[model samples]
Structure formats: structure tokens, C-alpha cells
Target chain A: MKQRERLIEALLALSAGISVLTTGGIIVMLAVEAAHFFRQVPLGTFLTDTQWTPLFADKHFGILPLVSGTLLTTGVAIAVALPLGLIIAIYLNEYATVGFRNVIKPLLEVLAAVPTVVYGFFALTVVTPFLQRLIPGMAGFNALSAGSVMGIMILPLVSSLSEDALTAVPRSLREASYALGATRLQTAMRVVVPAASSGITVSVILAISRAVGETMIVAIAAGQEPRLTANPLVPVETITTYIVQVSSGDVAYGTLEYDTIFAAGITLFVLTLVLNNVGYWFRQKFREQYE
Target chain B: MSNMTRNRLLDGAFRAVGLLATLLGLLLLAVFLLDILRTGLSRLSWQFLSALPSRFPERAGIYTALLGTVWIMVLTALIAVPVGLAAGVYLEEYGRKSRWSALLEINITNLAGVPSVIYGLLGLNIFVRFLRMGSSVLAASCTLALLILPILIVATREAIRAVPKTLREASFALGATRWQTIWYQVLPASMGAFLRELFWPCRGRWAKRPRCSCWGCWPTCRLRQKAPWTSFRRCPFKYSTGFRAPSRHSESTPPPLLLCCCSLRLG
Candidate 1:
């Protein structure tokens, strides 16, 4: 009996070890290469420089331009996805009949399962052509097109999370609001939405993190022009696009140019780590329980 | 009367917009599938599927990528399935009420949310660099294994928990050992549910066509069927074109068992 228990325990330990080893290995490797990067290029230069011409002799490595571009596209994606996702979530969770939601939810999930590269293709083939007709100089590969496609890609995530949060709000609260002669919209907006506010906020943050970390869409659609401009019409480079570009190019692994990818990766890693930490805290702290 | 009619108009407008949004989402999917079909149909011959990637633009195919994807998924399922089940069983049976187990459960949930590219970084370090796998199929497979392990364990645990506890009590009363009771009573009873859970997370990955197969790969020609052309040949019917897949497999190896496994999982 003791031997059997010991065996079970050993198996559990082995599984946990796999998880830890995989996650830890990533952090350690990034840190090693990123440290090497900092040694070659000053941390101040990497963090503060506005220009990102790393290959040239007078290389300015301030990552702000790339960071700003990422933020701008991410900002647009969230702005578009959030309200639209909320409306869909409200329609499904608050008002829709079971049959309607059954059809809509799976359709949305299938969209979510479609790869990011597919979304990039949609942006290139569909969104870009449409946008170019409307805006005279809208470049073929610009943040606006990328962000719109990304917004569509992330719609399911935001809606699903928000729906879960909204559903978890006690039915009794909505009932009480209705009992007081509140309209369906009024009850949902006043009673349920506030109660689920923290969960909804966390959902938005997680969706933003997903947008920030997405690689293939930005790599394929957003051109690698790291200009520090907020205008979405112009081509701009993101940190993720930069990572994909640097890795896919023919640079030798140990070269300074190659190490720059690691550095940019580290920066993206730190940002996502912080977002994940905050999102984790919100989820743990605000998980609503009902009898 | 006016206010009521106005309210009705507003409600109708809102509902229309709601329905339109839903249709728009569905239409996007339809358009995507239509485009893939439209482009890929002309190239959907047996030779296109069987041929290898070639620098000669006309001779390229997804043969290597399809093979690589199969290899990776098969190895991933092999590595992940047993470990995930055991860990899940341990958590459900032995440590169900333990605080550490709960903490580990929460950690796994969060880990599943981490981006897949992060898994690429992890694979680069642990599998490629540390283990010297050299960016081969093994590294990619193990990386994906780690990515799906947490999800598998969670699902497995849920399945185990859903098993009835009365059977365990009944077996224990009949002098069965705890391990024996769990093995014979709990595991067998929950086997179907376990399989259901095991396959769900992986369905998305398997069904997805690997992007490496499509990007920058040269196009290969598909068979173009020629209509039967003859004057005074057909009595009353018009000729039509109907292309068919090449009846050949000698040049190309058959897809591995893993593709079959994916179909099984989907089933």
C-alpha cells in the first residue's frame, strides 16, 4: 500500500516537473541572451532611443518607436473589440434564447480557432483593399488593417470571458431589479454589469495581453517600418513583428543583430508577464461564488 | 400612442443591428472558407498532396509539412496523454482536498492562458538548446506537448471527479484495497468521459492546416480534365469537364498513423 502511494506521488512530481522545467527554461534562456544584449548595447540606449536603426553604424536602439507602434495597434484593436464584444456578450448572455446562443457561440469559437495567419490573409485580401478605396494613401500593410483584423480575431475571447462573468452574477440581483419595474436593459446595465465589473475588466486586460503577444498577424500584415507614429494609416512595426522578422532573416544566431531579437523578446516578455500577473490577481480575487 | 410606436421603432432597429452583427461574423467565416476552397480546389489533386516541396515552382507540395505535422502531433499525444492522466488521477483521488493540489490546479489554469509563442521560446531553450534537439520535429512536438499538458490534466481531473463515489464506498466495504477500488471501479466507469476530455483540447490543433505548408511555397499544377470533344459523338447530351485525383501512391509515402489518430480524436 505504501509503495503504491509512493508511486502515485512520484508520478505527480514528474508531471509538475515538466511544467516547471518548460516555463523556467524559457525565462532563463531569454535572460541569458538579453543580458548578453545589454552588455553589447547599453540598456539606456535600448530603452530610450526613438529610432530603431540597429544595423547601421550610428545605431540608435531606443525601442520606444516599436513599443509605441505595438501599443497603437493594440489600442485600436481593444477599442474596436471591447464595445462590440460587450454588446455581443450582452445580447447572448442577457437577452438571447438558448437556441440563438447555441448557434452563435460555436460560430464565434470556430472563428477564434482560425489561425492568426488566416486573419492576416483576410486583412491583406479583404480589409486592405477596402480601406485603400476609402483612404487614398492607406498603405498595403498598415496598423489600421492589421488592428481591424486582429480585433475580429480577438472578438471571441473578449465576448466569451465577458459572458462568463456576466452569467456568474447572481440571478437574484437581476430578479430584484426586475421586481422594482426596471426594464431588461436597465437591470442588466445597473445591477448585473456593476456586479461583474471586475471580471469584465480582467477579461479586457487578458484580451489586450493576447493582442499584444500575437505574432503572426502583425508579422504578416503590419510592415516592418518602426516609426513612432500613432497614425494607424502608415506602416508601423511592432515588437512581435520585429521578433518574427529578425528570427526569420538570415542573421547568424550569436550576432548582435540576432541578440537584438532576444532583447525585444525580453521586453515583450516583461510586458506580458506584468499583464498576466495583474489578470491572475483579478481572477483569483474576484471569482464570485453563490450558494 | 406616439411614444409606444417610437419605442417599437427603436427596439426594431436595435434588434436588426444585433442580427446584422451575428450575420457579419458568420459571413466572415463563410468568405474565408470560400476563398480557401476557390484557390485550393484547382490544386486539390492527389499529386499535389503527395508531392514534395521543390524549388521548381511547378513541383512544390505540402508533403514534408504534412509529414512533419503528423510526426509532431503523434509524439505530442504520446508524451502528454499518459502523464496528464496520471497527474489528473493523483490530483483527483489522492489530493482532491489538499491545498497544494488546489494551488497546482490554479497554476495550470493560468499556464494554459500563456501565449503559444512563449511556448516557442520555451521549446527553443529547453528542447533545442539544452537537449540539443536542433529544431527538429522532436523539439516542436515536445513544446506542443507542454502547451497541451495542463489542459489535458484539467479535463481528466474533471472527468474523474464526475465518477460516482458510491461505487468506491461499495468496493471498499467488500474488502477491496483503495488502489484496487479506484483502478477497477473509478477508472473504468469514467473511461468514456476521460477519452472525451482527452480529445477536446487537441481537436483544434489537429484540424488546423499548418501555415508552414502554405507560406512562400511554390504552387503545383492540378489535373485539368478535358471534356470529351467530338463532333457527332453525343446524341443529345453536352460534354463536361470532370477532373479526378491521380491514381498513384508509388512516388509518395502514406501519411503516418498520427493523422489517423487525429481523425480518431475528432470522432
Candidate 2:
């Protein structure tokens, strides 16, 4: 019996050990490669410079363009996804019958299950073609098309999270709004949306983080130009796309060119980590209030 | 028109807009399934399933990718299940109501939200580079195992927490040790739920493999006709998730047809 008890304890310890090791090892590798990158290119050059031509002969290493491109695509994606996602959540929670919600929810989940690569293909084949007719000279691989498809790709995240948030808002709140002679839309837009603001905000932030870290879509659809422009129609590149471009190239090990990918990765990692923490904090706070 | 007429018009417009939004969101799913079926189904004969990715796209079967996915999935399940179950046990039974446990609880919830691609980068650095696993299937599988680790942990914890405390007290009163009480009484009571919690994420993780399209969806589709027991009895935990055993049933297979239509559109 003592031996059996010891075995269980050992298993518990073992799991914790594995989790910590995995986290630790990832951080260490990122740090090691980043250290190598910083040694070759000064920290100021990587962070503050505007141009990011690593593959060229004159190898400029300012990361602003990549950062802006990531922000731009994410910005456009949020603009498209958030309002639609929120409205869908509102409709599902406040207006739809239980039967309707059940059907819609699983379908939305199926949307989430579709791989990001498929979205890239959709952007390339379907979205880009549609957009090119509206905006002339919209490149085959423009950020706008990629951003729209990405918005669709992460729609489930926003809608599902916001729906969960909206569902958590007490029924009494909606009843009170209705008792005040508010319309259904008013009850949704004013009372429920405000009540669920924190959760919805966290969901939006989480979506932004996803857009920022997304690799496959932007890699395939968003062009590889590291321009700092905010033009949505023209081709633009993201940090993740830049990383893919560099990695896909024939850079030898330990070169500044190779190290640039790690530098970009660190930037991507830090942004996502911060956003994830913020999202988590909101979810916790909101959940605590309701509980 | 009267005010009543105007109000009805407004409601109709709102409903129309809502329906349109829902359809818009669901369209890609339809398009995806339609696209895959249009392209892949005619070509997905037995020959295709049994073959591997060839240099020629025409001859490219998903055999290696499928086997690799299965191999990775089996390993991920073996590695994640026991550890996740144990962690769940710890959080649910041993540490319930503790402040530290609550904190860990929140952390796990947040951990599950991190993007899959970030997990890829994490895998590239941690498993492939640091551990020298290269870009082999093993590294990818381990990466995914860690990716879904938090989900399994949270689900199992929820399952164990759902077990009645009365069961625990009963065992303790009968002179059972804490571990014995948990293992024999609490766990067995929650066993069905635990299996379910483990299976969903495991299935998802397997499907998330870079190479393979999921087969779980296939069994849910056309294959259930021959072996009605295949869906539920094949995997006990899957039964609770509304996967009715194919055996001992009527001659209908409506759900799989619907599922196939859905998968066809969404693929």
C-alpha cells in the first residue's frame, strides 16, 4: 500500500517536472539564439531601425517594418472580425432559440477546426480575386485579402468567447432591460454588451494575438515585402512572414541572416505573451465577479 | 403603414441580418467541404488511402501522412493521458479549495488559449533544437502533446471535481487511504467522464497533426453502416458524446450522412 501511494506521488511529480522542463527548454532555446542575434546586431539596430533587408548585400536590421506589417494585418483583421463576431454572439445568445444556438455553435466550431492553410488558399484563390476588382493593383498576395480571410479564420474564437461571455451575463439583466421597454437590439447592444465588455475585450485581444502570431496564412497570402506602409491593398509583410522568408532561404548556420529569424521570433513571442496574459487576467477577473 | 407594421418590418430586417451573418460565417465551412469533396472524394479510392505522398500529385496518397499521424497520436495519448489524469487528480481531489490550486487552475485555462503556431515555434526550439529531435514526427507529436496538455488537465480536473464528495467520505470512513479512496472510489465514479475529457482533446490533437486529415470524421460518416458498434463500442468514452453505438440499432445512419455533408462542405 505504501509503495502504491509512493507511485502516485511519483507520477504527480513527474507531470509537473515535464511541464516545467518543456517551458524552460523553449525559453532557453529562444534566449540562446536571441543572444547570438544581439551579439551580431546591436539591440538598438534590431529594435529601432525601420528597414529590414536581411537578404540584401547592405543588410539593414531595423524591425519596424515587420512590426508595422504585423500590426496592420492584425488591425484590419480585428476591424473585420470583432464587430461581426460580437453581433453574431449577441444574436446567438439573446435572440436565437436554444435549438438555433445549438446548431450555429457546432457549425462555428467546425469553422474553427478548418486549418489556417485552407484559409490561406481561400485568401489566395477566392478573396484576392474578389478584392482585386474593388481595389486596383491589389497584389496577388496583399495584406487586405489575407487579413479578411484571417478574420474569418479566427471568427470562431471571437464568437465563441463572446458568446460564453454574453451567456454568463445574468438573465435578470436582460429582463431588466426589456422591462425598461428596450428593444431587443437595445438590450443586446447596451445592457448585455456592456455587461460582457471585459470578456469581449479579452476575446478581441486574444484574436489580435492570434492574428499577430499567425504564420501559415500570412506566409502564403501576405507578400514578403517588409514595407512599413499601412496600405491594406498593396502587398505588405508581417513578422511571421518575414521569419518564414528568411528560414526558407539558404542561410548557413550562425549567420546574421539566420539569427534574424530568432530576433523576429522573440519579438513575436513577447507580443503574444503579453496579450495572452492580458486576456487571461480579464477572463479571471470577469469570472470571479460572476462567481 | 401603422407603427405595428413598422416594428414588424424592423424585426424582420434584424432577423434577416442575423440569418445572413450566420450563413456568412457558415459559408466557408460549406465551401471547404464542397471543395474537398469536389477534388478529393473522387480520388480517395482504396488505392489512394493505401498509398503515400508521391512526387506526382496525381499519385499522392496520404498513407505516410496517415500512419505518421496515427503514430504521433498514439504516442501523444500515451504520454498525455496518465500525466494529465494525475495532474487532474491532484488539482481536483488533493488541492481543491486551496489558493495555490486556484491559481494553477486559472493558469491552465489561459495556457490552453495560446495559439497552435506559437506551440510550433515552441516545439521548434524546445523539442527539435534543444532536444535534438530534428523535424521528425516524434518532435511534432511531442510538441502537440504539450500543446493539448492543459486542455486534458482542465477537463480531467472538471470531471474529477464533478464526483460527489460523499463518495470520498464514504471511502475514508471505511479506512481507505487518501490515494486508495481517490483511485478506487472517486476515479471509478468519474471514469466515464474522464475518458470523455481525455478523448475529445486527444482526437483534436491528432487531427491537428500537420500532415493528416482526421479519420474520426470518416467513421462518423459512411463506415458506420457495417459495424454499428464501431462508433461507441469501439471507444467507450465516445459513447457519452452522443456517438450512438452502431450496433443494436435501426437501419438508419442519418447523423453520419449529415456529418459527411458537413465535412464535405468544410473540408
Candidate 3:
């Protein structure tokens, strides 16, 4: 009996260790390939140069254009997601009846479950045309439509996380505010929201990280022009989009052009890692205060 | 009295704005579904379900793609469910507060935040290149299994944690081993939550297209056609190929609509 128990424990421990292995695999795989890439391209050129045409003969390898494109779309996405998500979260947590909340919460989850590919198609086929009608000179593939649709995609992330934070704010705080003659609006805005502010900030940062790393939506709808422009009306290429584009093609392994993706992958990995750690830290601090 | 009226008016206005914001999400979903239904309903026939890819848009069918999707789903479930459940069982039932387990906990949380695209890169390097899986369905399934592991593990841990301690104590009193107690008492008690948790990863693997596409899962359809279970490489969202031709909207629109309906039902 003791021997069997030891065997089972060993098996279960190995299963749990696979997660650690996966993290190690990601770091090592990215680091080794990115090392090969950095050998040829100077770190300065990779960060500072304004162009990113590695596929071309001239071989300029600046990552700024892609960074700008990523920032531009992320800026648009956060703009659309932040206010709308917060408002919806506020409505659901503070105002809605229990029955209404029950119905709406699952529906919001369904929205999140819908594939990013479908959203990419929607951004391409539906949103771009709608925007073109509204604003002349909107390119067929522009950042505005892609970013807006992406905002809607990540909206659930924001709303749900913020709602969880708001729900975690103790009910006694609200009663105290009411006891002090504060209106419902004043209590929700001043008391609950302030109390949940760190949690909300974590959600927004995590949502931004998601937006930065989103692939198909930007790849399909945001055009593949690696230009250093912030105008949403024009086309731009992001880091994930560039990776997808390269992977789809028949780029030979071990080539500098192929290695560019790993270089780009490391950049994306570092960025999302920093955002996630920050969010995790904030959540830890917030939980300590409450629990 | 005026101050009270002003406060009431502002509260009412905020309520109105909040309601509108909440409704906007539902509205977007409705519009998207309506558009898909209007375009795809007529083309969704038995013929569309049974046919294979053809150069002619009118003759193109989603049979091969559907087969590939089934293969991916079955294989991913086979690989991910067991490992994830085991990890969950260990963490909830057996893990002590050691530094190693603490590190395991933190690693899983951070892995949850790593982007899906990065997972694609990992698969490209590890499975496709190093292991020489040749971008087969097995490779794609393995990548997706890894991709969904963090989510499944977290869900399993929550479900297992929710199992009442009294049941375990009862089993222990009966002279059961730790594994037996978990298998018979805790797992059965938490089975409902476990099944519900299974739904998310299953739907997630179904909806995920880009990562598989990055692994070159599509091109193999044209190259290798031997076994649907082993080397099949058609992505369900290859409907995007049909979408390229605006006039063939009927051929392409139904598959994704069908995919959406099936996934929603699964959810």
C-alpha cells in the first residue's frame, strides 16, 4: 500500500511539473533563436531604426515601425474598451438586479468565447465597410476597424475583471456611505470604485497586454504596411501580424529573415510578461489589503 | 429640496448611461449573428457538409475540414484532460507549502497570461522543428493541448478544491489511500464542475485557428491525403479562402456560422 501510494504521488508530481517544463521550453526556445538573430543585427538597429523590411533586398531591420503600429491599434483598442467596459461593469455590479445579472453575465462570457478569427473576419468584412461609409478615405484594411473590433473582443475581459473587483469591495463600505447620506451614484463612484481602483488598473493593463498580443484580428484587418505612422485611417503591421505573415510563407529555417520572427517573438514575450507580472503584483497587493 | 432633485436627476442619468453601455455588448452579438445567419442560412445544406475542397467555389465543401477539426478535438482532449486533472489533483490534494509547489503555482499563473501566439512559436520550434512532427495534426493537437493546459489545470484545481473535506475524512476513516480517496470520493463529488470546466477548453480548441495556421496545419491538406486521423491538415476556418472571392460568399459563410452555432451549443 505504501509503495502504490508513493508511485501515484510520483506520477501526479510529474504531471504538475509539466507546467514548469513548458515555461522553461518557451524561454529557452525564444532565447536561443533570438540569440542567433541578434548575432547579425545590432540591438541598436533592431530598436531604433524606423523601417522593418527584412524580406526586401536592402534588409533594414528596425522594429520601431512595428512597435508604433502595435501601439496605435492598442491605443485605439484601450480607448474603446476602457470606458465601455468600466461602464458595463459598473452597471452590472452596482445597479442590475440579480436575475438580470445572471442572464447578462453568461452572455458576456459567450462574447469572450467567440473565436478571434471570427472577429477578424467581422473586422474585415463588416466593420471596414461600415467605417468607410462613415468616414471617407478609410482604407480597406485600416487600424480603426481592427482596433475597434478588438476592443469589443477584449471588452469582456475588462468588464468581468472589473466586476469581480467591484463585487469584492465589502458591502459594509456601501452601507456606511449610504449612512453618510451619499446617493447611490456617489457611493458607487467615490467609495466602491476607489476601493477597487488597483484591481481595475490590473484589468486594464492585462487587457492592453491581450490587445498587444492579439494576432488574427490585426493580421487580417490591419494591413501589412510596416510604417511608423499612428493614423488609424492607414494600414500598419504589428509584431504578431509580422510573425504570422512570415510563418505562413516558405521562409527557410535558420535564415536571417526567419530568425527575425524569434527576435520579434522575444520582444512580444517580454512585453506581455512585464504587463502580466505587473497585474499579478497589483492583484497580490490588493488581495493582501482585503483578505 | 433642489439639491435632492439634482442628486436624483444625476443618479437617474448615470443609470441610463450604464444600461446603454451594458446593452451595447448584447447588441453587437445580435448584429453579428444576424449578419451571419442572413448570409449563410441558404448555403448550409447537406451538400455543403459532405463535400471536399474544390477549385470551383460552388463545389467546395467542408467535409475534410470538419474531419480535421474532430481529429484535433479528440486528440487534444485525450492529451490535455488527463494531465490537467492530474496536476489539479496533486496541487489540491497532495501539494505541501514548499518552495517548489509555490514556484509551480506562480508558473501556472504566468503561463495563463502568455499570449497564444507565443505558444504557436513554441510549437513551431519544439514540435515542428526539433521533434520533426512535420506540422501534422498530432503536432497541432499537442500545441493546443499545451495552450489549454493552464486553463484546464486552474479549472480543475478550483473544482477539486470545492469538494467538501468531510467526504475525504469519511474515506480516510474507511482506510482508503490518498489516491483512492481522491479518485472515488473527491472526483465523483466534483464531477459536475469538472465536466463544466471541460467545456471551456473543448470550445477553446475548436475556436482557435491562428495558432494551428501558424503551425502550417492547412497546407498539409494539399500535400498529404492518406489518413484523416494522423496527417489530416484542414482547418475549419479555411472558409477564409472562400471569403477571398466576394461573389462566393454563400460557399464560405456557412461553415463559420456552423462552427459558431456548434461552439455556442457546446458552451
DockQ each: 0.14, 0.15, 0.45
- Residues B172-238 of candidate 2: C-alpha lDDT, one tens digit per residue: 9999998989879988898887665544322222111111112121111000111211111111011
- TM-scores for chain B, listed for all candidates: 0.71, 0.68, 0.85
| Candidate 3: clashing pairs of residues | none
C-alpha RMSD for every candidate: 10.1, 9.6, 3.8
Candidate 3, after superposition: displacement of residue A226 in Å? 1.2
2 versus 3: better DockQ goes to: 3
**Estimated TM-score per prediction?**
0.83, 0.82, 0.93
What's the lDDT of the predicted structure labeled candidate 1?
0.66
lDDT of 2: 0.66
Q: What overall lDDT goes with each candidate model? A: 0.66, 0.66, 0.80
> Quality of candidate 1's docking, in CAPRI categories?
incorrect
Please provide, for model 2 over A1-291, each residue's C-alpha lDDT reduced to its tens digit, 9 standing for 90 to 100.
889888877677567455555555556766888899899899988888889898899889999999998998898888878877887888888779999998887677665555455456557756888888988777887889889888886777788778877988998889998898777877787888898888788878877877887776776678888888888877788987776555544677678788887788778778887887877776667653645
